[model samples]
Target: MFCYQCEQTDRSDNLLLGCHSVKGNCGKDDRTATLQDVLIVICEAIGQYAVLLREKGVVDPTWAHRASYWVFTTLTNVNFNATVFQRMIADAIVLRDELKARYEAACTEAGETPVVPEGAAQFVPDPGMAGLLKQAPLVRVDANIDVLGADVVGVRNLNLYGLKGLCAYAHHAHALGHRTDETDAGIEKALAFLGDPPTDLDSLLGHALELGSLNLKVMEMLDAANTGVYGTPVPTQVRVTPVEGKAILVSGHDLGDLAAILEATKDTGITVWTHGEMLPAHGYPGLNKYEHLAGNYGSAWQNQHAEFAAFPGPIVMTSNCLIEPQPSYRSRIFTMGPVGWPGVRHLEHKDLGLLVKAAQALPGFATTDPERSITVGFGHDSVLANADAIVEAVKAGDISRFLVIGGCDGAKPGRNYYTEIAEKSGDDTILLTMGCNKFRINGHDYGTVAGLPRLLDIGQCNDSFTAVKIALALADAFDCGVNDLPLSMFVSWFEQKAAAVLLTLLALDIKNIRLGPTLPAFLTPAVVDVLVDKFALKPLGDPTEDLANAMAGA
Candidate 1:
């Protein structure tokens, strides 16, 4: 396996660029890794054709969206099925050939010869695993690292990984019937950029920053999609304990699927509980209206192995971050919409009848648990609506500083740092949290300051933009730059989505961000130095010491 897309990629004292073992640290084997690389290379070629078609005034949004989907499926720990990737590769080649014919015909009509790149544009994919494995080394991430050098490889990966995250966000938003021509065009351009990547370090670095800017736009569009389709999130309390009934636990980030399930099972006496990143769905008024839409059931995505096993009823993964199923719950686990496993039932036509039937058949929790709940739904609109009060609290010294302490969470050993940082924060500090990392400290009582919950849960990882808006509002109210505000960010990264968020933060010039549990293995030492020099990005040390340093600086 040669995968280094996530922060948890195997990195020993000697090696850093990739995990070249038989199995990656994330449990992906050599076949899946090789297939993922082949899929990406094929997608890049498709993007090349799409770019030519766009240049010829033919606007087909399908190619751009499919390119994004192909990239998104290859994200760290998302898809592990070699069959799915094989199908995608086959589909991509078909698209590539069609686009190539179109581009050549257009060029010929214009009395010009079409210039086609050689790698993926001309190469044909093997139909079988043996042939695919033979071609794997030709397209693996480190295939050209020796020639392009570490710094250039690092920047190229930074852009690629960030684009992967951007597409994931855009995919979810698009599923909810919210996507724009502007966003589609940007995705095509970024994918084409990948087809013909910049070799020089400076150009690659510039492209990485441009990717950051593009990610910001995609994130903003996602925010609009989530809030515009569903009502803007408000402060709603979500129950942590289950109600006594047949239950369906929904995991992952797709509200569209969740909505369909809720509507399908409405008034059926079966309860729908959210797990993992779906915890924030309770905040949306459109979703919250379902009385059977019960509370959250699990912690972060990494804990699903245990949590899903213990849960008594059907469990549905609506999107990414699905792990290999345990035998205990594998029979009951179902995947929907882009996420898949070898044997798991994949839901199509937006139906959850099988899941509902499973819930009805299984004996759910016999009795209700203790009445425990947490406050969620403090998104940008909710926070900004209370802007005057927050400004006053800061001025009166009631709220000392704001701490943005959340991002993607993983099963790494040192992730407890986020929990400790949230726990040990001073009474005067307000910790604004979004994403799955909030699961670390969210179960604990942080108490309130100035009538506001110190630990604010601002929707999913995509809602990082809401946190950005809160920062901008504070900076604007304070009449200073965003970095100048009495706010500090401590981000815990596990995947490329967090990488995209980090890039957006850097693009906005938000400094002094402390990122952990570790930096991406794809980033070389020189690239790390460049980030430290330019954006003041800090790798996490001791949690108490880091919190002390942040408070002291504030």
Candidate 2:
């Protein structure tokens, strides 16, 4: 199979042969490869439209949303259906031709080679036919370097993956009636860079960081869109035990779907419980006010197989990570947005009749357990509102340090480090978390500091924007730079969004972050050195040792 969705490949060529000898690696077959090809074509087409819109000073919400969704769907492990992808490609090409014609006419009137959309697709010349176009090229610069061995590929993977997250967030914002010209332009520019010819390892590394920078802007736009529409998150205590009798458990990261579910279920005698990243929805002013909005059920995505199996009612996944649904819970598992698993019901539109019917048919959720409550919210707004109290706590030595330990939670057992670190952290320390990864420490009884819960679940992964906001606010309140604040980021990364957030932190000049469980396969020594020297980035070590270093450094 031919593949080149990332920057790193063998023989200075963008394409690579599938390692047929190795099973489960890449999990790609010929069909998947073709689908990826189609996806690249669609991205190019979308890029072309995006560039046109940018130049025309007119933004099309539908085009922007569709484009972003296309990019996100191409992310690794997201969508593998060749038929669906090909249809999307067909749609994209149709749109591309229409936009190209419009652009060409406008340009002819003004006199110039119409600016080929920022991320426009290029036809590759076939080696066999001299100049004849063979097929469309993948959306990655041909960084044919062996400089850092597999590290180059790793960096490439990181960049592409981060773009996927950026696209996903941008798509979500578009859905919410929020639009930013700068974000739209950034997507076009970044996609164009990804599809450019390969440069040096250092240059690619810079692009990786740039992806993070752009993601920050995208995430900020999403943060504003979410908070503006839903109100700033406040500290909330959500119950873990299902409310006895009929209920629905909603997972994944789509707030819009969650809101819609709440609305549809209103006065239906069905209690709504949250799972995974959806747990933090409990903090939102509008969501929290739901009388039937019970509490969170599971911790993170990885534990869903068992947790979901044990769940008492129908479960809906708005956008799950690595969806490996067990047959036991498969019928109860409903997918929405881009998330899908064969045989699982997918609710893509606002219609929740199926969910309602399923909830009504099922035995319904169990009663809320008084002993099982998980506190949520603690987002940027809540944290900043309590900035004075936090400052006072710090001044009084009640809080000596703050650690941000949150990112993608994977099934790998090594992730236990996060829980261990949280459990062992000093009583005077504050743990700020986001994403499903917070489940690692969510169950820990770290108590509180100055009426503030020690562990703060700041919402979904995109809420990393809130983490940055809190850091900046704290720094400002303390009359010092962010690096000077008693704050440490020990992030766990498993996908592109994590890469983007890491880059944002580096861009902000936040130093000495400990990243792990394993460093990205990307990041050549030279590139890593630049990060180390410039930002003091370090790989995570033993929890005990890292904690000591963190406290000592603070």
* Strongest candidate by lDDT: 1
Per-model TM-score on C-alpha atoms: 0.97, 0.88
Query: How close is each model in CA RMSD to the real structure?
Result: 1.5, 4.4
Top-TM-score structure, candidate number: 1
Q: Which residue runs does candidate 1 get wrong by more than 4 Å?
A: none
Q: What pairs collide in candidate 1?
A: none
lDDT of 1 by residue, 163-282 (tens): 889899888888877778788888877777877786888788787787788888889988888888889898998999978989999999999899899999998999999998999999
**Candidate 1 Cα lDDT to native:** 0.86
